[model samples]
Target: MSAARVPGYAELLTAADAPVLQVRGDWTLAHYRPLAEQVEGLRTRLGAGIRIDTEGLGALDTAGARLLHSLLGGERLAALAADAGALSGERRALLRAVAAAMETAVAEPAPPAGSAIGDVLEHVGIAMLTFRQHVVALAGFIGITLESGLRMLLQPRRWRPTALAANLERTALDAVPIVALLTFLVGAVVAFLGATVLANFGASIFTVDLVAYSFLREFGVLLTAIIVAGRTASAFTAQIGSMRANEEIDAIRVLGLDPIDLLVLPRVLALLLALPMLTFVAMVSGIVGGMLVCAVKLDISPVMFLSVVQNNVGLSHFLVGIAKAPIFAFLIAVIGCLEGFRVSGSAQSVGEHTTSAVVQSIFIVIVVDAVAALFCMEMEW
Candidate 1:
């Protein structure tokens, strides 16, 4: 067992018709907790001609003096300070000071607590503000790019055809395998789902129509655009972010050449040119995959599938899908190049901006695609 603690205290005693309270132990801030607890009930004991004995007390501090003042009123404390041998000179001065200051101290009112609804509203407001900021930034960037593009149009010598070609190859031809493969797999999955569902209605042959319509109008361009957004957008951001990190963008500026023209324009133009072609390839690949599934599972031959697609699906659906390509392409390239320019010197910043580019591109593409789908439905095209 541990030894008992030496806590600060006050003990009362009665002698000669007078109550005596003896205060003892180290009454500094460190020991104030126990000291305060011990003296909690001592207030009721104070009566006429009460004697407070402080000579037995251990080390005393300002906190101790304040406790002493609280036990006895300021008058009694002042009286204690004035008395002979009651306290040391320094302690007496401290007690007198505490009594004087505590007399003038005013407590401020407490602040109101926050509520759940207020906190939720605050977060929503902040999100809306951030969204507005992003919209404004995107619009400004678009304007700057458009202005630069117009300048290049007026002056054809400034066009970086070589850079555009290189970016096109990277963003288009290099990406064909993944884009084609993913759409092909998705097409097969769609076909499987359609066949299983349509078979229940004794209309399994309509699976060909379903697959053709989906791939030609919606899935083809939408899937290709989404894939390119995730693939090409991130690449563009990383490339330009690297240049920014290495200060090559600065060097280009120092060399008196426009970074927008030399870097941004080429990537933007490349994506603008590449996405449509990729969309075409994706459409073909998806249809072929779906056709293969139809041939194997539904016993539908390639010739019949082609005939059904040609006779049933109009040229309008294909046109509707292809028309969205340039818009998706432009948005993805701008988002990517914009995020790349946003990158600071750090590798972490490059990575963060690259991720932002991909997310923004994909989000924008999906939203626009949805809106286009709605518009097309309303127009009956």
Candidate 2:
């Protein structure tokens, strides 16, 4: 094998009228480091009448040409090629191409400027438009999903019991411990706060009513739905998005299978089944936790707690909370599945859609719950 070639070097010479820089040797990537340093040093000391002599220039590559062009200003570098008459034809062409590329890159138009308030307004307007588009798309997806679900409902043989059961196990059974634990802790905290505050008014017994009303009318179902939105919605998006990225969804379509029926329906049905049950579990667990706190801190017996809950927190509150669950479940599932379907054929796309599914599900759930609460209040439910 040939011995490794010596890297390029530069020599600076001062003349009567101007300074001259002589470049030599194999100016390729292998010889780049020292050449770059020398070029940078020359750049700082470069004067108005400086000239580059490339008579000894050898084995020039794009990297070396770019380095040389960068060391000299663009117009000045072109002048060097014209005046020096020493650069080889190939090296001169490379320098010109690099100079042109640099010029194009630097020629990008400046961003428009505006007042801070105007900029803020512009961003808000764009956000509102994007949000409108998202709402329309999601509404369309929900309609299509509902139509598909109805068609499957009318066909007994089309029901996917196996898939539904599997999803139920994954979404409901697997989530039970965490859901119960979280609600239990939240319930205990609420009870403690109630007892402490109501004690000042000599109405510690009212703590039972507070715990029961909050859990049954809001906390139980709302907390359950939020958890489901984060866990199950993201899972659905990731699973479906992966299928899309791998072309599994396309294969299903080619096989004359309805992607909505085979993939989305079972998951949606399972969530619809799971969420209400989870909410019920959350209610029971949270109420029990509150009862324990009341018993310990407020001298309220379990019997007394149950009696107060029954008398003061009516069945209507429980019914109202439970009614919200199925609606929330349907929205979460549809948003998840819809975002999944939107994923392009890339891992990054799957990841992006998965995150979007979680955010959209949680946002929609909160908005729907708020609207439902206002409607319920207006109706005196």
Q: Model-by-model lDDT, in order?
A: 0.88, 0.89
Candidate 1, superposed: residue stretches over 4 Å from native: 1-112, 344-347
Clashes of each: 0, 0
Clashing pairs in 2: none
Across 89-117, the per-residue lDDT of candidate 1 in tens digits comes to: 88788888998988888988898898999
Q: What TM-scores do the predictions have?
A: 0.74, 0.77
Shift in Å, residue 331, candidate 2: 0.8
> How do the residues 1-381 of candidate 2 rate in per-residue lDDT, one tens digit apiece?
112254677778999978898776777887888889888887888777777776676677888777878787898767765653676666667778878887778566798878999989999999999999899999999899999989988999999899999999999999999899999999999999999999999999988988899999899999999999999999999999999999999999999999999999999999999999999999999999999999999999999899888778889999999999999999999999999999998989989999999999889889998999999999999
The candidate maximizing lDDT is 2
Q: Which stretches of candidate 2 lie over 4 Å from their true place?
A: 1-106
Question: Model 1 reaches what TM-score against the true structure?
Answer: 0.74
Weakest ten-residue segment in model 1 by summed lDDT: 1-10
